[model samples]
Target: MTSLAFLLPIALGMGLCGLAAFFWALKRGQFSDLDGAAARILIDDEEDIHP
Candidate 1:
């Protein structure tokens, strides 16, 4: 029972933090475009300069 003092709050805090981050990401358009990155990778970037 004593272990609950440490474990319960930590678990609750982590869950809340995860939910907050998910909500923040939703509000900030983090998940707006799911496919653009994959499409970008397929396109050749001619402007890139590599040594």
Candidate 2:
């Protein structure tokens, strides 16, 4: 019973922090190139290779 009093606020605060980070990422366009990254893996970087 006493543990709930201490744990509830901590849990809610952590959840809010996670939500804020997700929203910040959305506003920063972090998810805008979702498909580009997946497709990029299929392309080769020829310049980086050395013989």
Candidate 3:
């Protein structure tokens, strides 16, 4: 009972922090190029590098 009083605000605060971080990432374009990154990894640029 007493623990809930202390822990509830902490839990809510942490959840809000996570939500804010997610929104911040959205504003920063962190999730803008999801598919491009995945496809880029499969691309081979070996010809551009000369040994």
The most accurate candidate by TM-score is 2
Query: Comparing candidate 1 with candidate 3, which one achieves the higher TM-score?
Result: 3
Candidates sorted by TM-score, descending order?
Answer: 2, 3, 1
Ordered by lDDT, highest first, the candidates read: 3, 2, 1
- Against the hidden true structure, what lDDT does model 1 obtain? 0.93
* Candidate 1 lowest-lDDT run of ten: 42-51
TM-score of 2: 0.88
**Per-residue lDDT of candidate 2, residues 1-51 (tens digit):** 999999999999999999999999999999999999999999988888965
Instruction: List the pairs of residues colliding in candidate 1.
Output: none
Off by over 4 Å in 3: 47-50
**Residue 8 accuracy (lDDT) in model 2:** 100
Candidate 1 stretches with Cα past 4 Å from truth are 49-51
lDDT of 1 by residue, 1-51 (tens): 889998999999999999999999999999999999879889976778553
Candidate 2 Cα lDDT to native? 0.96
Distance from true location, Cα of 30 in model 1, Å: 0.4
